[model samples]
Target: MTTTTRTAVVTGAARGIGAGVAKRLAADGFAVAVIDLDEAACKPVAEEIEATGGRALAVGVDVADEQGVQAAVDRIAKELGEPTVLVNNAGIIRDNLMFKMTADDWDAVMNVHLRGSFLMTRAVQGYMTKAGWGRIVSLSSTSALGNRGQANYAAAKAGLQGFTKTLAFELGKFGVTANAIAPGFIETEMTAATAERVGMPFEEFKKAAASQIPVARTGRPADIAHAVSFFVSEGAGFVSGQVLYVAGGPKA
Candidate 1:
């Protein structure tokens, strides 16, 4: 199958890294499903893709809800075609020290990051299996390596790495590849929130972060998107269960 003609489903695609990934995938020629918690939130991204001569369907879905995820996947298959490419990019952060963290905060992050990926993968696996080929990319984070005030977020992100490896092993024989991208210091709304939480100017925060990175630069969402594109390419069939840290340098 031609790469440009394939269908892809990207969760949390309304903005930030998810939006970047969705746009990049569309540029690669896939008919994309722009899925976010609020369907209306996805319109601008979807419309942008369409305006550029790409096919996209805006789907409202709460990836944490099994039923919602199933329905969204079904809709994509019906409207866009069977999705062989799936990006589990939906996530949220509930940052707090372990002692002060609430159960709700922990559950919310786990539900959206880990559970959501699980549900979305399950819903789309059928289409991938039927086609005998697929690409599954989940967003992990440098926080997985361990970060202060991010116990819940760190655990959930780390879990995705394990989940991705298992999928690669289980689905490799079917011409499917599963991988994770652990991004570091990417410029996104999430990071902006982190800066706000810490009472730092966003620009100053990014600059401080860049000073520590070996590349002397903070990452862009597009940088992470490029990594995802590589993993999902037709030529990447033999590469599976790998976690590429797109953090501009080796982890400290």
Candidate 2:
């Protein structure tokens, strides 16, 4: 890839929203790096992009691990060109009420969501600064506003908003734009798991969630991807430090 060819690194890209984002970026003409905890798991996504005549690389990394994240970024730079777009979407949920949440649960969620974003952003900022153009999108959630049984998740998601705004303030002059996307009730494997965890039938959960959304339907991965695609577009240079709520309705 040439310097003129934009490259993107998307964490947790083996499936769900991350996978959707990776595919969308590739379709938008980016050389995409599909990153996940298991490199092998990223192959299908990467292959799908490649099969569609787009460039892609699969990278295995634990986003929460500083050394691992640094190494992954370095490898991507060497192989795919200096990545100018980053999607810090790797996350995990440890759902429990504050009283019942274990210390391990809180720490695990914090490490993956907050600490992972920090490490990945720190590692990739140099590349972005060098390129003098970059797009950083972090996945937040409506849970950031507060959710039952998600004290740890809520705090971490809220932290990403502050982190994104600060990054935009600091890096705007360098041609880097940082933004957050807070999705509400997206239908994905994660949400399916949530349904099971709460002992509700998946279809019933979707119906219940849909009733609350103004659009009268649950969100899909592609909906969020469309928002991300716009944010990373070259024309979006003027749009930064914004948090887009991709729920079916006004969250506030």
Candidate 3:
């Protein structure tokens, strides 16, 4: 099959790392589905890809909802031509210390990260099995190593690692690869918000984070996107069930 015929679906693609992954995959010659909680939010990403002479579709989906996940995958398969690459990038943070965290906050993060990936991956794996080749990349984080004041967020991210590995084990024989990218200190709106929450200037926060990294630099969405690009590449077929840390240095 021609590269143009392949389809890639990226959730939470309205901005940040998801947008970077979507754009990169589009540039790689796959018809991309730009998905976010609001369909309208996805339009700009899809349009940007189109402006670059690539094909894309905007899909709004709540990845944690089984029906919504199914609908979104079905639509992509029909319109984009059988999605073989899936990126589970939809995530939310309910950052609070365990003492101050509400049950709702914990559940929200769990639903969005862990449950969301489960539903999306389950819905799309069928398409992959049919095609006999697929790539599944889930967004995990350095927080999975346990971040302070992020009990819910960290737990959810950590859970995705097990989810990814199990997928790799079960689906490898079907010619599908499942992996997780655990990024550290990526400069995105999410991190900016975190800085704001802690009453620090964004630049100061980033610099503080950078000082701790061996690379002496913060990360960008494109950095994680580059890693996702490799995980989804045909040459990466032999690589599966792995968690790649995209941090600037080894985890502390």
Candidate 4:
């Protein structure tokens, strides 16, 4: 995006891909709100941005809580500025075979991925609509297509695609565009946890995953961050209701 005084909020931004996206937006000249479940967790990223001459605020709030979400967004508006750009990147994985999945696992995934996105979007869209311009990018996953042992995650990611498309339809008239970035095999703490769960060293797991990727390597936080940068750029105004797969290959 061209340098603007606009403010952007990136949820789950304490680390990994969300942190990368938050920093990138700050570099792109938007005052950024780095939000996570823990405000302290967000300080490093927000402080780094400010140290680099960018405006940033670290806010703590649960995206899945309605009142908390509203209160957080309101605080952002007052402390930062009208947030017209949003990245819904907060998520959790409760991977399990269908027969082994618990209702709690499913609910937890749905509440954070689906409900969180909905509430965050709802809280931010008013500013977007009133401003007559906005960009929203939600994190989806290749799992959405179907993933073994990730029924809960796959369903939530797939649901977000539908959610993103609907937002495009409903908000297009107001000059707001919505899109999703479905990443595949990005190296992060979450993936390391997966490796541990499966009894493999994280490095070996990445090597095995890389062998199958056309790019000859796994994706990284920067890869997804670059994709988000594109979707929210001023030049991307015409793109909406789209899912861009940044999986280092045409298919994931």
Candidate 5:
């Protein structure tokens, strides 16, 4: 929110929604840090930002690792200036019916979606508070409402809604706001994987999903990005502790 140097850090920015968000924030005039587990995978996104005459940095980090997350944040602050905007978009899916789910599957989802968000937010909040202004947006999903094979994912995402609200309450005095975006049926690599897991062609899966939505179309990464852009914008300072359902219909 500071006009001097608005650096944004977006996790899982190598591809999909994270990448889209990184690009959008860059265009919004923030010095963006494109972070992913594979630093190499993050290069293309950062490079694309640079090509468009925006500043960006590619950093490799496992968001659930305490040391890794702290180190990545320190580096971003030094390289791109203090990160006042943090997008916790790094997540994984381990979908299974409860009877078929393994403990590992459950832990994996929690570690990435819950623990990862915790670590990343902990690391970045200091800069935001120091700047006296910030925005934190975590990606939730319609699955948080309950999906057939996503018990673990649903729990983790639901947990994030609470996390965002708590952050909003705790950080409001520092001019920091936190909100969650629960997207529905977004067309991304993750959704493609879901389609494969369900033995449906990706195109057919999109069509089937679109048919049930009021918008009559599957959501795109850019759609999520647009919502995020609003949350992080200067005008959204009063908005916090909200879970925005970006589903095509009235899902919330």
Candidate 6:
């Protein structure tokens, strides 16, 4: 009841963590904009929310495209209401050792993770500023802590942390809080792909990963969603500019 019917824009929401965050926000009383690279791909998540009697809208967005991002925000504003919550969750991985990493690989990761977040946030903040209340959450990763063969990804994810803090510094006066969620070992298509890249069965990979964690388990999208749920809640207004490492014990 505290969040009203504020709109929340979650990028890369077609599946995985983005979808989880979008679904959770809708349940938390926000009309969610389920955004991804393909509008059609976004429909299922939006439809699922609507089936649960929550409001949702599907949008296609190339977060790195400035004009496309602006247009997407405008559409979400006109259709679902002005978006007061923004989640920069869209990203891709081009993992390789620095020796074999290409410029294209680096650019692809940076464009989606950094430039995309930059573009989407820039487009949506106006609505938040006008309302004087907002929550901006970006997805960071444990990989940001200097993972091997992930130079580009590590840099991009690390960049999001800085971005979150800066937004907090500049937007706190507007009653907008910014935070980042750095997740570890979440089971998703992306993680599955990582396992495949290493020619390891996902179950075996998960088992190996779980053994390293104090919790002796992997994470799910819903786990990250719960953290996001709290960060965007009315009670979380004072909890900003923090990087929450949701990896079992500490160390991230």
Q: Which structure among the candidates has the greatest lDDT?
A: 4
Candidate 6 on 62-162: residue-level lDDT in tens?
Answer: 99998999998999999999999999999999999999999999999999999999998899888989999999999999988999999999999999999
Clashing residue pair totals per candidate (backbone < 3 A):
1, 0, 0, 0, 0, 0
**Candidate 1 lDDT score at position 22:** 98
Q: Between which residue pairs do clashes occur in model 3?
A: none
lDDT of each: 0.94, 0.95, 0.93, 0.96, 0.94, 0.95
Query: lDDT tens string, model 1, 1-252?
Result: 474488999999999999999999999888999999999999999999999999999999899998888888888999999999999999988888999999999999999999999999999988898889999999999999999999999999999999999999999988899999999999999899989989999999999999999999999989988999999998999999999899989974
User: What TM-score should be assigned to candidate 6?
Assistant: 0.98
Model 3 regions more than 4 Å off: 1-4
- Give residue 73's lDDT in candidate 5 (0 to 100): 96
Error of 6 at 5 (Å): 0.5
Residue 170 alpha-carbon offset, candidate 6, angstroms? 0.2
Q: Residue by residue across 1-252, what tens digits does model 3's lDDT show?
A: 364579999999999999999999988888999999999999999999999999999999898888988888888888887889999999998888899999999999999998999898888899899989999999999999998999998889989999999999999999999999999999999999999999999999999999999999999999999999999998999999999999999874
RMSD of each: 1.1, 1.3, 1.0, 1.1, 0.9, 0.9
Which candidate, 2 or 3, would have the higher lDDT against the true structure? Answer: 2
Residue 29 of model 2: what lDDT? Answer: 92
For all predicted structures, in order, the TM-scores are 0.98, 0.98, 0.98, 0.98, 0.98, 0.98
Q: Model 6 segments beyond 4 Å from truth?
A: 2-4
Tell me the deviation in Å of residue 214 in model 2. Answer: 0.2
> Model 2, stretches more than 4 Å misplaced?
1-3
lDDT tens digits, residue span 20-78, model 5 = 99999999899999999999999999999999999999999999999999999999999
Please give the lDDT score for candidate 5: 0.94
lDDT of 2 at 201: 97
